[model samples]
Target: MADGDKTIEISMDRARLDLDYCYDFIAASYWSAGRTRGEFDRSVEMSFPVGAYCEGRQVGFARVVSDQIAIAYVADVFVDPDYRRMGIAAKMIDALHSHPELKRVKRWLLATADMQPLYRLHGYADLDDMMMMRLDEDARNRDPLR
Candidate 1:
């Protein structure tokens, strides 16, 4: 669970997640600036979430939505400003891809406005023209707890 320095610990245990730390960091993030607490909590409840820590204090977080059979979508990968570039994010992603429940997944997907190079280490590539998405303009207005 420790990174190269062995000072960081990464955990997939849902109970170990620090909600207060995660919500505060993600709420102000450019990608999820307006995300509600309920939405964040629901996401954690439904997904295989991972947290990176140092000395028992959380420093990073990521999650993967998967079926435990095949296919996975990686999202919400955030490392604290003071903890970036320490291979924490990579370790979290590796934890997901190599986790016993998801190692067999054939396809993994994620979207990042920047930071492509960081993901490249995990075998993520540029999307092909065939890839597409449809949006729900008011999805945010929808209740996540519902």
Candidate 2:
């Protein structure tokens, strides 16, 4: 959803995803830097991917890793710089929640240095008591070939 001429359309189908655009954005992103196209494709294949398109070109993307039962881990949420603040991310999350396989999911998790307010609207609270711990190294120091 956008204000003016730029109307964003959300698609849940992985086949509709713009591989080059999504892979390029993730490859250069701070949180997912050095990720190869093959790895990105595999992730998309295994997860539920959402794409936001503007006039046919992909402008935003997000994905959820879930077992279709207990929990869903939302990840790789990235909106193109030009398409930010227009509710694309929120709409992606909405699509995830309304999805047939995920509508009944009891738990949802995501990690972000910022954007708490956005997730809060969806009832995600700060996990102050038990934080999400990761085993991998920081994305910035990670090797592309590793």
- Listed in order, each prediction's TM-score against the native is 0.82, 0.84
When summed lDDT is taken over every stretch of 10 residues in candidate 2, the lowest stretch is 130-139
lDDT of 2 at 16: 88
> Each model's RMSD to truth, in Å?
9.2, 10.1
> Candidate 2's residue-wise lDDT over 29-145, tens digit each?
777877888999999999999999999899999999988666789899999999888999999988987677665566788888777778878777788532232221132342332
TM-score, model 1 to reference = 0.82
Residue pairs with clashing backbones, model 1: none
RMSD of 1: 9.2
Compared with the true structure, the alpha-carbon lDDT of candidate 2 equals 0.80
The lDDT for every candidate, in the order shown, is 0.79, 0.80
| Weakest 10 consecutive residues of candidate 1 by summed lDDT | 130-139
Which candidate has the top score in TM-score?
2
